[model samples]
Structures are given as structure tokens and as C-alpha cells.
Target: MTNNLSVVINSDAQQVWTMLREPARIAQWHGWNADDQEAEINEIYFGPNVVEGADHTSLVVDGGDVFTLKPVPTGTEVSVTRAAIDHNSEWAAWDEDITQGWLTFLHQLRFALERHPHGKRRTFFFSVPGTGGSAIENLGLSDVPAPGDPYSLTLPTGEEISGKVWFRSNHQVGLTVHNYAEHGEGLLIVADQPAIADVRPDGGSLAIVSTYDLGAHQLDAIRNYWDKWRAENYPTSDPVH
Candidate 1:
């Protein structure tokens, strides 16, 4: 099966290339902060299995995934052609989950380069077993909006957020929250995971909240509020740190 995912970021090819190759820059969007994040990144991205294109426009990472960069009028188009999954492999059971993860990370990369080019992000993530409901609907965003459309809504938690609609897809919705970061920039991604045979029988819901430049107290407050909100809304869900 040919699975190719791409995103256009508002940055030159060189800048996007830097993000793809540099460890510190990769941390800005690849995954949430963790004690072993740095080591994990080094292993997966800089390990012996990786290969870089002679012209610096492509990268072949572990597991045979290929990333190619092309300069577009607006910026750079970064595309990833995923490697085929082997049923006998350890990660075969999570194939769909991995694809969804790539989608999230690609958008996060775009968000990082365009919105907070030089800033480190603080992230919050959660994955919930579906309750026969849409997670996007729960976020009060059921009415799908076109990309770049402006929106303002008070969340179920009584938090007022306003920004442009980042992007929408069949299984995911992304938003820019102007009030989240210190300089009024943040990214929120909500996704619906369909049930797979022998895996995630009830389906699932996933969300990622990325913010920048927040003080410790402020970050703590935001985390606490969301923690309470998630507990109330997704009592059975397990949050991924």
C-alpha cells in the first residue's frame, strides 16, 4: 500500500530542513517532552539506520520511512512516504495508530515552524476510548470550518479561546488558540480513531495541546484545569504524557 502524507509549511526549504535534521529542533514538534525524549530522538533519527539524501532534500529514517522536501511558492512541502507494515513485526498491531501519529506530528511541525519558529513547546496529550461520540463535537467544534477561517468559542470548561481554524480532515481537526501561549499562539489537535480488528475494539479519541513561553505557575494552572476537565469528560481515558 502506498501511504504518503504531506504538509506545506510557511518556511523556506532550508529552515524546514534544519528542523528535520537537528535534534533540538526536532524536539519542538516531534513529540511531547519526556525524560527519555532526547535519547529516543537520537536513536530514531540519528542512529545508524538513517540516511540523508545527497542533495539534502530527502531523509530515510529507521524502518524505511522516507521524507522528501520540495520548495513551493508559499514555502516548503514536506512529504513522508510511509514504509509498509509487517504483520509479524512488534508494531503491527498499532499500524493505524502510527499513521495517525504521523499526521499529528506533521501538523505539529508546520505549526512549530510557522507560529513559533524558535520557541520550545509545552504539550498536553490524551487518548480516550470512544464513548459512541465524536471528540471534536465534545470540544464544541462539530460544525466544520474551512481552513484559515476565524473562530471563537468558550470551551466546556468555561475557557474562552479564539483563533483561526488550522485544518480539518476526515478523522482530525486542528485549531490555533490565540490565548494559549505567552504571545497568543498555540495549537490544538483533536482526532477520532476508528476501531480496528482485535485492537481498540471501541475506537478511541486523541488530543494534543501545544503551548509556548508559559511560566511555571501558569503552565501548572492550565494543566490542572485540563486535568480536571479530562477527568470529568473522559473518566475512563488514559492520558499519554
Candidate 2:
């Protein structure tokens, strides 16, 4: 079935458009800075199978995926509408992965723009096999609040974050990683990586920080900490076949 999601950001359409359309800006809110953003954006948005709106407010990509920007009283309401999934396709799991990936990335976009516009970001990501159930407690989030409720915790790396619970489900935990009054907004996502049938269960955690002017030294520090933490906590996942 089709999947879609939207967020009311606290900025106007023009500003959001700049962030979305500009490759350098997209890196601040979307993927790791190492991503080939311009290439990906062109492939997805400017390719042959795309239709653009007159005001450039919306686009229809191949396979009927729709991306839209609508001005609201507060700011822009950004949205994505993915075409329905075909469960019988060979890439059925890939279809679900894209839908969930968009959900996470769109929220990252909203958090960056609203909290720290024009910021740069660093990402930390790793995955391991699940213990056949949720690892919320193992991750030290035993005190996590109800969805939308405010919460704060210090990671094993000694960094602390405070923000409302963005989402939580059997397979994932999403946090609006507002690190006290010091750092800008960020997103921490814990998810079960999708797998084709007959594969072992695996879970992943990702951290994306909106660092306004922090240099590479700072990013390296956080990255090192996460690497150590993951090694100490998560078990080695199954090797690829």
C-alpha cells in the first residue's frame, strides 16, 4: 500500500525550497556529508520521468511518488507520497525500506531547519542482529517517555540529549536529539533493517547531528565514541552471503 508523511516546519516555502533543492544544504539535513547529494537529487528529481509544478511547489517522480511544498500559517508543510507497494515484486523489501527511509529523513529535515538553519551535520550509523525482541533497555533508554513526551539521557559516550520522543515502535526508536542548551537539534534513529525473507533479523542505530560551526575535530570525537560504544555493546551481525 501507499505510504506518506508530512511535517509543518517553522519556515516559509522559499527557505525550505532552498534547503531541499540545494545539494550543499541537503547534506546539512539529510545524509552523511560524504553523500553524493547533487547526483542523487538529479537522478531522482530532474530525471526524465519527473513532472514539476508550475510554481515548483511539487513534483511527481517515476512510480508515482509525489513530493510537495505547501505554505501554511506557520511555515511550509512538506510531504511525500510514495506509490503503493507491490508485494509480489522481487524488490518488495526495497519498497518498504524507501518508505521508512523517507519518513526518517523528512523529520531530520524539519529538525534541522527549525532548530539550526544552515547547520552542517555528522552522522554515525551501525547495525547488528536483534536479540529477537526490542533492545530499548539494552540501549539504556529504559526511561524513555511516551511518544511526544519530553525526555533526556546521557549516552555512554558522555554526551547528553534532551528532546521529545519523536516515535517508538516494535522495530524503531526516533528521538529529536536536542542536546541540552549547548548543541543544536539532531535526530537519533534506531531501526530494524529490512531484510528479504529467510534472512536473520538485524537492527541499526543512526545519529545525525546539526553542528553549526563545529569543525572536523568535534565530529571525529563523536564518531570515535560511537564506534567504541557499538563494539562494546552490539554483537557482531551475520556476514553477508
Candidate 3:
């Protein structure tokens, strides 16, 4: 099957392979920290559900989803091919949402390896139903500059941020902020989810802000600001940490 999501990380295949295999390295790019994060990782990645190739280049997780790595001229090409879903399948209903999630995580992996390979990350996540608009629109990022172009703007919370465009897709955009972490490096990803009829009538929006080596007070302030923003913008949807 064709890859459902793919990214070229600016690192060697062995490095990417290490990240895929080791739990510690996987934590660098996978989901945010939570009370059950380690348990969830073990169950999904190292448990009975995972199958690894002898050469360590391919992995099959949770039955049908496959992760593969190959060396390329630029670096390493990492790809994920999701299991096919039939109408009767349990995942058929949330296929698109799951695809979007893969898209986000793949980019996060690329960012982790390319930008902050060894740094511990602290993330602030916000996912809420769309109110006919998005965080991209609210942040005035509708007319985005080309990737690597520098940008500076003041957030609704009165914080001024300056960064460069990292990447952009049809429904998502990522930016690198210079003032977020101790070493002045961070990533902000904004995604717009389309309405899925009965499943997600109002659609949705997701924002993931990843900071490395950020002070506690600064992180808390950032979280509080976005939390308030989510509440005011989409009061009906419950806030997600």
C-alpha cells in the first residue's frame, strides 16, 4: 500500500531508525506527556502488537500500520502506511481524523530530529471544534509567506513573537518561534479539520506548541494564554491540555 504519511528528516537512516525503535528516542517526538504516557507507549509500540523487521528498517504496529525508513540523498525518508479500512471496520468512522493525526506526528518527528534532536520537549496542546474559523485565521496567518521567511506578530494575548515559516500544507502550517524556549527555539503547528458530517459536525482545529528547555513560569503563562483563548473562541468544546 502507498504511504499515508511521509517526511524526510535531515538525519541519517540509522538515526531515524533509532528514534523509531527506542522508547526514549520515540518519546522525543511522539505524543505529549501524560500520566499514562509511558504505559500507552509500551502497549502500542513494544507490546504484542508490534512486529519489527530483522534489519531494523521496518516496523508494523497494531496489526496493519507500517513504519519504514530508507536512506535518501538528502537524509532519511520515513513513511507510515496505515491499514486499509472497510465500511464495517471500526476505524472507518475516524479515518480522516487519524490521517490528520499521522500528518501532525510525522512532522513532529521531522522537527525533533532536524531542530532539537536531544532536547526535552514541553508541549501545549489545544483541540477544539471549529467555529467557522481557525487558529490560523485568528493568528492572521491566512496569507503565509514562503517557508523560511521571517515573520513577527503580536498574539491576542499581547505577546510579541518573531519566527520563520517552517512548513505549510493545504490544511496546516508550522512556524519556528525564536523566543519560546531558553535557547530561543520552538515550534507551533496549526491545523484546520474539516467537518465530517455526524462525527464532527462543527469540524475542529488543533494547535500544538512545542518548546525546548523553557522555564516553568514562561510555559505556564503560555499555556494559560492559549487555554483562555480556546475557551473564549470555542466555548462549547471542552479544553484539551
Candidate 4:
């Protein structure tokens, strides 16, 4: 089955098109990459069958995923269309996940273009068990949000951030982290990672994809805080991750 997602970015089509073709820019906005499995980005866009256009890029993967940019009066209309899935193939099992993954990346493209145009990001990653009962509650988020509502959260580390909710699902929450001053904003994704059972002790990963250079000390401080919080909240039975 095919699936697609679209967003109107507040930038010109040429600018957005440039970001799509550049590997470094793609890393800033998309989740799936060809490497770095520890995080969501894996460099999948650089595949050989890729076709680049004035405002589009068509790639053949899991069938074919076409990325296009249409010029609008305001900016550009960006979309990713996933071709029909071949059920007999190995990619069949990953159909839904790939669709959702593209959705996440498309929104990320809009977020990066609209919010942090020329900013760079430093990503922090960690995982915890999925059996926790009060972890989401303890994070000071009373509930998940739809596409356009305000969401304010206070992390277990006592860092507070407030911004409009980007997207949320039963197993994931994506929110704009708006506390970076002039440096750059952030997209904080808290999601379950059931597919990666081989990595951690059956849990999910927290991705703080931010567009600021919060330095090593500050970054490590937050990472340590999250690790400590995870240790206290999710005592894993296995010694993985």
C-alpha cells in the first residue's frame, strides 16, 4: 500500500530543494539515514536510483519514495509519496513503519525550514524499558497533543520547554522544544522502539534533535540526567543497551 504526507514550508522551493539534495542538510531534517543506526537518521536518501529535479527528488526504496516541492505564494509545498508496497518482499513487514517514518521526516523538513533555517543540530539519544507505568506522567506532560496545540513539558531533569505540538501518536510524542534562545530550536521525540529489541532491554529511545550547540558539558549534563532518570524509573532485567 502507498502512503504520503505533505507540509507547506515557509521557504522558497529552491531553498527546500537544495536541502533535499545535500546529504548534510538531509541529516538535519530527516530521520532515516544510511548510517548511524544508534539514532533515527540512516542516510537512505543518497541511494543510487535517486533522481533530483528543480524542486524534487525521487528515490526508489521499499518500492519508490518520491519527494517533491511545489512553489506556492507563501513558500513551498513539500510532499513525500510512498509507492505501493510489494507484500512478497522483505520490505512488506516494514511498510507501516516506513510510512510513519516518512511522516516524521516530512514534518522535520518543515520544522527545520521554518524554524531553524541555517542552524545545525546536535542529537542526543538514549533508551529505556517499555514497562514503565508513570514515566510519561513523571515528565510533566499531562497528555499528548494533536497537530496544532500548545504543549509545555518539564523534563525529569528540571528543564522546561514550551512550544506548539507537532505530532503525537499512541507510542510517540513530537514537540517543538523552544528554549534555545537565538541559537536554534529543537524537536523532542519520545517514542517506543519495539523493533529494536536487540539493542536495549525492550524499550524505546528518546531523541533530542536540537539545532543548537549546547556544548559537551551541557549536553552530557542532560544526557546524564536522563540516564539517571531512566535507571531509577526503568530497571532493566537484561544488561543490554
- Point to the candidate with the largest lDDT: 1
Q: What range of 10 consecutive residues in model 2 has the weakest lDDT sum?
A: 203-212
Query: What is the overall TM-score of model 4 with all chains considered together?
Result: 0.75
Per-residue CA lDDT of model 1 for 159-188, tens digit only, reads 788899888877888899986799968998
TM-score of each: 0.92, 0.78, 0.91, 0.75
State in Å the error of residue 19, model 4.
Answer: 0.8
Q: lDDT tens string, model 4, 117-183?
A: 7777666555455567434455655486776788776777667778888776655567887664346
lDDT of each: 0.83, 0.66, 0.81, 0.64
lDDT of 2 by residue, 18-120 (tens): 8766667776666545446657766765678988777868878666788799999989999998877788977676776677667777777887788768556
* Model 3: how far residue 159 lies from native, Å: 2.6
Candidate 1 residue runs with Cα over 4 Å from true position: 1-4, 197-199, 239-241
- What is candidate 3's lDDT per residue for 1-241, written digit by digit as tens? 2224888888998888888878888877777766777887787678887999998789997646788988889998989888887768776877777777777788889988988888888887877877647778887777878877998888775668888888877778888888677885788888988787787887888888888998789988888888787777778766657
Stretches of candidate 4 above 4 Å error? 1-4, 32-43, 54-63, 127-129, 133-149, 169-171, 180-184, 193-206, 237-241
Candidate 3: residue 146 Cα off by (Å)? 2.2
lDDT of 2 at 56: 69
Report the number of the highest-TM-score candidate. Answer: 1
